[model samples]
Target: MINRIHIHLSLLVCTILEIIPMPISFGTYRPDWLLMGLVFWNMFHPQNMNIGIAFLYGLVLDVLLGYTLGMHALAFSLVMYVASIHHLRFKNYSIWQQSGIVGLYTAFHNMVLFWSQHWLNDAFFHLNYFWPIATTMFLWPWCFWLLNRVRRERLRH
Candidate 1:
């Protein structure tokens, strides 16, 4: 169906956006747009984007961005799996609570990615990995609102 295609397209765009590098000054604090999208998809249509898909997406990201082979995939799959388990809870949480959880999730995701990068080559470790978590957390409210609106409108249509 066209609707399904649109959903996939949206997620793909979000993932591509994630691969593009932002300012280095922003450091590890960059927002996890793909992670956010995965969570959004799982929250609304868990059947569409499950753990397997999350892992695949992670692998693709690693290849596209030249990260360690299974690093992003592993973290992404795990985070998505955990998020999927509590999709309903995410929907029910207050904005503050959701933001807090997202912050923690992004932080952990960044740590795993950093570890994987170093595993691939000793040159990948840096102190900046923590920044992405902070930045992603700051962006969580905006991301959740925007994506939630999209999900709601599509459902309405």
Candidate 2:
């Protein structure tokens, strides 16, 4: 059986990491922890980590970070949908290939957030805002590898 408790604990840790404030200069470049967690879990545990769960994660993040309600919910849900639908195919991909796909997913998530923020608040546009796309893409392989090792180890015992 999949370990529900471990899954939740991992998500809690990701959420904590997401909210930890960084310096303004670096904060804008922070990878989306919650997005990565959702992507990883959904990719590996599609049955358990579905869109509803992703929506909840995003909702919690919205409430915590004081973003527009449902903004993250929508973006995360979209990511989950894409990941779950392609989980089988993605599972067979090489690590680098998986990372490239994940990079695209992360960029899509960010684009949705950017557009929504613009629509809601008329937020200023900056090319620098796209930094997380590269950072997330760059970090995906390590995050997936580390999480996969931990997941395998936990499930083995």
Which structure among the candidates has the greatest TM-score? 2
- Per-residue alpha-carbon lDDT of candidate 1 for residues 1-157, written as tens digits (9 for 90 to 100): 5456766777788887786767876545557888878887787787877999889889888898877688889999889978989999988888878888988888778777767666666656666667767777788788888877877788798
Q: In candidate 1, which residue pairs get closer than 3 Å at backbone N, Cα or C atoms, i.e. clash?
A: 28-131, 28-132, 29-131, 29-132, 30-132
CA lDDT scores, all candidates in order: 0.80, 0.87
Q: What is the lDDT of residue 85 in candidate 1?
A: 91
Q: TM-score for every candidate vs. truth?
A: 0.86, 0.94
Best by lDDT: 2
lDDT of 2 by residue, 1-157 (tens): 5576777788988899889978878987898877888888887788889999999999999999999899999999998888888988988999888878888898899888988999999988888777888888888888887788879988899
